[model samples]
Target: MKKGTELSGLINKVKESPKTLQKISPIKPTKDETQFSFWIEKMLLKDFKLIAIKEDISLKDLITKCIKEYIKEK
Candidate 1:
């Protein structure tokens, strides 16, 4: 079968099964914590990841530690 034909069939199947697309509740973070998303320079992200790996900690933990230290200094 052709690519367009396959895609059209898939779309038709999805259209026929409207109930398949069920609404889901947003995931709640534990302990009232929230998730954050942001963009950064590629080089900066790469360096940050390397630092996190070297410290054997998660990226989130490393960021949180840095932010806490920064706030304390201020």
Candidate 2:
């Protein structure tokens, strides 16, 4: 009876792990998710340049803004 209860507890732990991990994700992009444009372009960089030039904001300020938004989305 003890062995059977132990096995059931192990199965329950396995099932709960996926939901418990929802808040955790890698900081870097994954291998299979890669695309060609992901290498050639970055939205943060482009938006930083465009907003900096158009708004007369400093590049550093625009970059900080973009990074904050990116992290928020993640």
Give the lowest summed-lDDT range of ten residues in model 1.
Answer: 14-23
lDDT of 1 by residue, 1-74 (tens): 69999999999998884565677899766776677899989998898899999999998899889889999999
Poorest 10 consecutive residues of model 2 by lDDT? 31-40
Deviation in Å, model 1, residue 69 alpha carbon: 0.9
lDDT of each: 0.89, 0.74
Clashes of each: 0, 0
**lDDT of each residue in 1-74, candidate 2, tens digit only:** 99999999999998874646358766896544433222425776786689899999997667567769999999
Best by lDDT: 1
lDDT of 2: 0.74
User: Which prediction has the highest TM-score against the true structure?
Assistant: 1
